[model samples]
Target chain A: MRRRASLVLLALAVFFAALSPLVRWYAFPRLAKIPPSQYQDMVLEAKNATLLDYTTMKSKKVPEVSIVQTLKGNVAAAGKVRERTGRDVVVWDTLSYVADDKGRMVSRIPERYVFDAHSQEPVHAGGEHVDGDPVRRRGIEYKWPFGTEKRDYEYFDFQTRTSAPIHYKGTRTVHGLETYYFEQTIPWTKVKVPKKLPLGATPETVEQLGLERWYTTKRMFWVEPVTGAPVDGQEIHEEEMRWTDKPGKKPLTAFAGHVRMRPDYQKATVDLVSSQRRLVLTLTTYLPWGSLALGGLLLVGSLTLEARTRTRGRPPGAGGPPVSSAAPGDPARARRPSPAPGGSGGMAPGAVGAFTGAFLKLLPGRRPPDQLTPAARVPSCARWVRPLRDPPAKGAWDSGRATRPAHPGSPPPRTTRDRR
Target chain B: MRALLAAAAGLAAALALVLAVTATGAPPGETSKKPLHTTVPAHP
Candidate 1:
């Protein structure tokens, strides 16, 4: 019965151990989900640009462009799972307003994003269908395993309303925690310039000021593996314009500056990542493996005890027929005696009985010596009677037996049976 | 031995449930109060 219980325990341990990977895949991603009614305010600045006067054809002092943007968003669960996709949809709305250095309103943009609840990838954004596997959503990537290499991801750009390929650049330590590094670079493209330039120039003069090309924009993110949160981010936006006919001329510096996430945000992200990582490590790695090891040991111990019990229960003289005690030339036969109940020329029956009684007492569910019946004690006594029945040869004592006497006062050998 | 193994299995199951429920119900990390910044060099 005890052995059966041990086997059941071992099976349960194996089951739990197998659950580790499932927790990592399903539970870990959910940690990165953005909740409803979340609000964030970010301040951005466009640094020193040449204040150009198109009417006077002269350059004034440089001016700074400052922007304060507020983002308020919410996520809601879909009522039913969509067709062709067994997962429910998650709807997200982010309303943002931007203001300049003088507190004048710049732009108010309302964006909508829809994603599959399971994959956390954008299905729709900005009233347009975005079809592709998403590498990231809301500044967080979904599922990144350790040792991941130069994998390419299709990233959706909210500003451009398009998807672009981003590359993983391996891992880096951020705030003392290892993180996956990913980068996206948008090349220079000829884009129609916005009506308002940072330096207070009109659209026609802006064209003449050489600010027509969208020079380059680079984005980098340091993402925590367990939670997939971006602990730190860097964005570099650059632009230059040229005359409609002049292609090779020195291009004027339209805008040049770098935007970085605030220290407070990074710190918060780091704390979240650390907590999530620790939880994952304990649940998925330590606990499962620990249970398996301990359960395995217990199973082995139970089996070993059962085998010993069977060996000890064997009848005396079962190994071979009884030999004559008077055989003079056969010292082996003379020294050994049949281990049968009431046998003679062997160890004392009382001593053998006491030793077997003590051994069985150590096992779980077995009666102590004082409670066992004489009939029950006979089999145990027969097990050890042979050694005591035969007296040792004269020279046997001289060899080592007398000198290496067993410790009389020592306690019985410890056994796992007591653990039950 | 049986009790210990049972306890371990119970612990793992409980932890998995807690994590799954928390992930589904609880909010993520709060946004920072500070705002992002980009400074144009004065001499640029």
Candidate 2:
């Protein structure tokens, strides 16, 4: 029996080990999906969104982000980063779409306009800044082709899968004020290697790595639940995963980053705390790995139980000899005499009846006093017997609290007399 | 008789181990229904 139990346990361990990968394959994908609508509107409001841009070394840890808001067919920016180098480093091109009186895009503008200074100047290539105009010289240029021809995206439909219901973690503050926070398990989309770069490296390698891991986005929204105002919010995407590029690298510990917005929704501050650039990827891999391991364990345990239930007259898990029928005088059957004179109610001569009559008292209902104090006759039996047969009633009483009234001086109370 | 006894003992042992691990390894909350406390940040 002991051998069989050990084998069963070993089999269970193996089954769980084998099922680990399978469980992960099913669970991680589901956990990774989240509703796209939650952030789609805000993302459109914060047009040309860039969480972090590590294009140049000067902005190594710092991020150059932009949030655009288009209104009355005119685009306006709150915090737009323009690299003010002496030369024209980068250019901004405006997209124009022809709209009817009903305010719907009918056709797109053919020629793209580049603004160096004035809107009248039809330049081939655009510059970082427009000359002549003071605001245009200091700021990036914004131009439109002609009347009823300007581009604007009303809403952004981000491609994302729907998953489990998000658990409302209640509200928290980004910079200040209350905001509704929600959390859900989700996995990252598989990141393909950059073909332009050498074999597996690219400028956006870190960002790609972070996107490949499984993580839960902690999203906070500060809205006038009544007025439906987009006041402030934050998002912290985190995961735990191992580095595929560097073997033996410790998994990224708590790959967490937070982006907070001002009440006006004009400004947002993103702070990323990462030991390595590929933190999110590392986190994503490990969480699913751990969850899968637990699932595997459960699977293995169930399989082992099923195996034991297979009764073929042979031991369930043991490779040893098949168990045979026991002989007539097995120790188990010999433990109790056939047709016991006590008839199950009485105790053996020298044996204490504490187990026989008094055992039932331990249960929750009524029990007789005689049965409760069964050891009362031990001293009388010892006196009647030849050798020091029965243990002294006093010693037995002292040993167990159940023996108190079983002694000679402390006689067992009469139940009939108490009833009268 | 011996086979039956051994099977009973094995089942008991397995049950005890499962109970021990479950009781010790459960998460931070008990089964009783208790109101959750939420911290609402003040308006800034």
Candidate 3:
């Protein structure tokens, strides 16, 4: 019964060991996939300096205004690979609309983003890559190697239809989970500005607002480690236009402030962290250790069962066959005479003793004698010399010291008796 | 039999403890529900 149980436990251990890697490779990727119809909201506070009075030459102080944007998106597997690129695709449709304090829509933008399904790189949306170059679409949540510092990434921007270099800044704890932080700065020289101005603005005003040549955007993202999901984000949009062409003149402020992640976004991040933690713990920690513990238990049980069976078969009050009388530390103690013919009683006792002795030798502070011969210490098939129980008569044929007749014609060797 | 049962029980207990610790510990989320606002440099 115990043997059967141990075998079962061993099988279970193997099953769990195999399951760990399966969960890591197959189950985790499926769970980490972005579900369709996910909704996110971002509340941005647009700050812009307004002229208090056109007549007055005083600097204007404009209070910050709040603009809430709701983002609704769905990701779907594409039916066929693109003809030009020959890559599998996934289509993402997102609609973002700005709302006022009362939640009334002010402006709506509908965007269709197509990405390579396997690589998750943006293939076509606002612009096409030249000659099948891999466009870096950092906005997608599928980028990997989240916690490493090996390479920087080029993040694509949907609004400007450009990509900016983003570098790993450091690690930070968000909502109890460790996250990788990244920052991207688009300098004023690289910022693309529209050629035309709005209705109320003149050329002088547009130039002074830095709407012509001076505008920059800085973005930061805190991404979850395992899933590569951005949990927290901040974006700062800055633009300055000067009234004079002189180099030393201070520029007028257009818009300056950060757009922080909303609560809904934070909740999404926390959910991703929770899911990732569960998967990682199961794959890397719990399953492996559980399998090891089960295996250890099985081994101990097997050893105990074998010992019990041997003890049960031994006759009562029959002390185990006499062991060697040599001192425990003596080198001769390692050698034991072979069992006599038809003597089955000594085999089990000898096996148990050998097992114990080998086990004890593995313990710390115990050393085997150096003088012990290899034949005595290790079981082998080769014949070894053993002291005879009684010496042969002076003239009897003695194999130990016997020699063949020299060249088949030599006289027999003389014995000690003959010499005496 | 007793040894085996004891070892199995201990392992089960350890596995339970691991599951409990991992499941109960909550991931950090945003502390405040209110929106945060910050000002950036106009000229940089």
Candidate 4:
């Protein structure tokens, strides 16, 4: 029985040990994918920002500018792309709407980003574009990949409509979660004018006016490494309307401010990312380490249990014919050190019994070791290990003498009452 | 038998933990109920 129990324990240990890496490497990679149904919205604010007054063709300072960013999962689009590309793809219909404090819309850009759910790498399938213009997407956008490394990653810039390397700045903690800080500096570059501009302005009209739009930004993000979620984000965004017809002309500030996630939105994002961090940690760190530790402990426990059972079967003088091998009246039988009247309560005897006894307590209606029959104490070892004397019909407890026969050198055997 | 039950309980607990971990990774739905780009009024 004990040998079987040890085998069971060993098996359990092996299962737990194997489950760790299986979940981390095999299952996590395949199954830990971004759901095609996930959608999220965030609000960011640029305080004391400057915006160009298109009617006056001049920069105007504003108390605040709000940018509401929404990302809606395009499940139908994702399904089509997945079929074509043979990859698990996700589509996010994203919109960044900028509005003044008075709720007057300044600008809004709509985009459809498609990428691999796990790697966050662009798949470049059909229906990829920014602001109704078909364009190939490259590099990470909106989010980093899971297990983000401390290295540079190519990040997409919507203004420049290109990919640039975002350098890993350093590590920092945001809302008590460790994160990797990354920054991207988009230098002054002539960018395409907005398709639709205020005051009846369009790209053609801006070109007719000999004015070109230039943009630069220093974007910073604090991203939680485990889930690749941003806890806090900021951007020093600056845009200008420059003169292409004239030389050394000062450009009109189109929009400029240090944009930051709204305080409440930042808190909300941190809280969400914190919870997700725990989930990722469970899969990558806690579960794997815990399984390994449990496996090691159970392995040791089973080995101890098996070894004790074996040692318990052999007598002090193992050289002698095994305990029950000698006949009842044989000199070898008479010399064996017989145990006292106390029984093991259907368990192994000695210190090992004390160890296993705690687990035995889980059984219902089990008698205490001291009250059980000597026959109950006799473990289910091989027959040769049983007492030299023949067992009584109903076990030793049913017989008047509860104790086994004493060795010739020992004192007489004691009954249960005498021991009491 | 009792030890086996205890071992079985441990295994069940471990399995439950793993299940919970995997379930947490399963994205449920839209995190925010706000309407999509439709909510934005035409750019003024």
lDDT: which candidate is best?
4
Q: Give the lowest summed-lDDT range of ten residues in model 2 chain A.
A: A73-82
Ranking by DockQ: 4, 1, 3, 2
Writing each residue's lDDT as its tens digit, candidate 4 over A1-420 gives 776677577567656866777678756776657788887788888999999887788888999988888888887788788788888888988988888778767777888999899889998887888888888878999999999999999999887889999999999987788899999999999888767556667889989889888999999999898899888899999998888988698989999999998888788788888888787788788978898888878766765555455445444423211123344345554555543222222223554345544443443444434444443344322223233445545656545655655443233454545433
Q: Estimate candidate 1's RMSD in Å.
A: 14.2
Candidate 4 stretches greater than 4 Å from native: A319-420, B1-34, B37-44
What DockQ do the predictions score, one after another? 0.10, 0.03, 0.04, 0.19
**CA-lDDT, candidates in order:** 0.48, 0.29, 0.45, 0.72
- Pairs that collide in candidate 3 are A175-B28, A176-B28, A208-A241, A210-A241
Where does model 2 exceed 4 Å of error? A1-60, A63-162, A169-215, A227-230, A239-242, A245-247, A250-256, A263-420, B1-44
lDDT of 1 by residue, A232-317 (tens): 77768665555566777666555556756545555765776688677656644665567556645654454344334333444332
lDDT of 1 by residue, B1-44 (tens): 34345445755674777566755665433334433222211221
TM-score of each: 0.53, 0.21, 0.51, 0.72
Q: Give the per-residue Cα lDDT of candidate 2 at A162.
A: 27
- Chain A TM-scores, per candidate, are 0.54, 0.22, 0.54, 0.76
Per-residue error for B1 in candidate 4, Å, reads: 22
Model 2 agreement with the true structure over A199-307: per-residue lDDT tens digits: 2344267455642233455544443221123345455544333456766655442233444443333333112111221232232445446645653564344333322
Ranked by TM-score, the better of candidates 1 and 2 is 1
Instruction: Tell me the tens digit of each residue's lDDT in model 3 across B1-44.
Output: 33334445544654554456544533322222322212221211
Per-residue lDDT for A169 in model 3? 86
What is the DockQ of the complex in model 3? 0.04
Model 3 lDDT at residue A365: 39
